[model samples]
Target: MSHTLDTYRLLGRSGLRVSPLALGAATFGTEWGWGAEQDEARKLFDLYVERGGNFIDTAGTYTNGTSERLLGRFARDRRESLVLATKYTTLRRPGDPNSGGPHRKSLFASVEASLRQLNTDYLDLLYLHVWDFTTPVEEILRGMDDLVRQGKVLYVAISNAPAWQVSRMQAIADLRGWSPLVALEIEYNLIERAGERDLIPMAREMGLGVIPYSPLAGGVLTGKYSRADLTATPTGTDDGTRKRFNLGVGAVTARALEIAEVVKEVATELGRTPAQVGLAWTLRNPGVTAPIIGARTPAQLEDNLGALEVDFTARQLARLDEAGAIRLGFPHDMLASDRMRAETRGDLKIEARQ
Candidate 1:
């Protein structure tokens, strides 16, 4: 099925423009076990490009580099046709000690390995993947700038880093004339509003493209396993199949069911599925540059890609907002207080209506 997405947007703070939805190759091969076969992986890549997807994300540690190698083989013929983004800083070996870190040596080595596996001379964008307090800001910045200079990476980005630290890196990079971050890969969704505290604002201010990894929140937001869902029982998390693995969220569990019920209603009204409703809700967020959809099969990818057709009216969005809404907390909560609003409006003679 063809998609309506045509023009691409510039990657966060960078000159690279990519499709609104990117294909995540974390499930490309079974380096970590439980992944698509190589032939199936190739088909998935072809289908994504067929649907106009132009951005791809992978990592060195994903399936112990199986994902990157598979993507490299699949894209070698069409490398210039897509915007490829991969990450470093995740450990694959247990006792290597220097296998993964934000340090210059690790970054350099990781890129070299990734390049060999990816069969590419340069990356469109490279992310640090996570923060490591062991490395100083200057060292990290200079190291990444060196990669850009060496033509190993076209742009530098950070993922899962604190707002202050991200800001400091930017400050250091700017002062020293090093490369700036162009994107932020974060765990963000409607049910998880924690990023709003600082990450969201910082990304908006710094012009970083926000690529939400799990827009479906490990199927939590998809409403697939709720009691009343009438869908397949959720895949077992016993063998560590669950992301956020085992946090034991009764509140989230209950809320997700409630949200599932609401989603069923909305989906019925719109003639769509509950999953479609959830994905569409995430798409309505203006701050998100794209949602990385992970699929183990062509059929699964089809289901997610179909979500682009699901649109929400103002009233529909308001309902889902109430269902999956998370408390902003702290200053955000204080600012939302009616008393504060009333006080601020008093100077304009906008007193309480009562």
Candidate 2:
């Protein structure tokens, strides 16, 4: 069951092929106060590409744009061989009203900025970074289609959008013959299984591949944190380390620590790092196409890559699932109830399609 970086998989319904784990470039610059510098970033990029990884994920505002710049420099020679994916919709100029959002103006402007920063004529994949909820779906879809027709972007995808909105957009694209969203990037990890209620299921039916971010639960599932971290206080500052940021964002909660402990036990049983076990759990999901791995150092990156080789026993999988299980909520729970199933299908046993 072990696979290497070159063990490429098709991205959703598209003909495009990418690595099982995308190299996240958000850690490519130190402008964020907690990432790798130029030389170190180059080493990370080289290490991934040398191992046959082609999917590189970034955003326009990551590290105040330094992330994309470094990726641009490091990927210059192998640009054609790599799939450079960048996102938009984050406000670049704080005071500018038209600098951000999911509207046409912001879409076009952001694509242009991403293209310039990536140092490529055309982006292999472009994602709408965040949903503003104010813009109409038609406007967003049309603008993305226009970019595709203009040869500025090869594929269009989305991240951090509601399930209903994404499915509606997919329907609109299908009806109007626009560029359909091929991938969905969301925060999914052992600690964050909320996506399981709808997002993951919707993507499976809609033909969009699920690309999970924060598979380590912001490093909580990596077992580097202890219950003591739950009591840690944050130092409010513009420039902060990831640990401080995690504390501020409530990512170091007692419940999260408990899950990490279970992950640690499972990792011990499997003779692997908790980081690898956490990542492998995400990879095991049938709906996930790839999980984005962000590492500030080459050593971290190497340890994360070991996830592809870590397999689990049924008991181990069950333990991990029980540790981080979430309720499907509302209609899902109602629809899956025994009474509903009995009413819908009595004693007849029917095989469901896979």
Clashes (backbone N, CA, C under 3 Å), per candidate, total 1, 0
User: Relative to the true structure, how large is the alpha-carbon lDDT of every model?
Assistant: 0.79, 0.91
The deviation in Å at residue 147 for candidate 2 is: 0.5
* Residues 113-157, model 2: lDDT tens digits: 988888889999999999988999899999999999999999999
Model 1 worst lDDT window (10 residues): 243-252
Best by lDDT: 2
What tens digits encode model 1's per-residue C-alpha lDDT throughout 188-239? 7656667778887888788788888866666666555645433334345433
Error of 1 at 271 (Å): 1.5
Clashes of 2: 0
The runs of at least 3 residues in candidate 2 whose Cα sits more than 4 Å from the true structure, single-residue gaps closed, are 236-241
Candidate 2 structure lDDT: 0.91
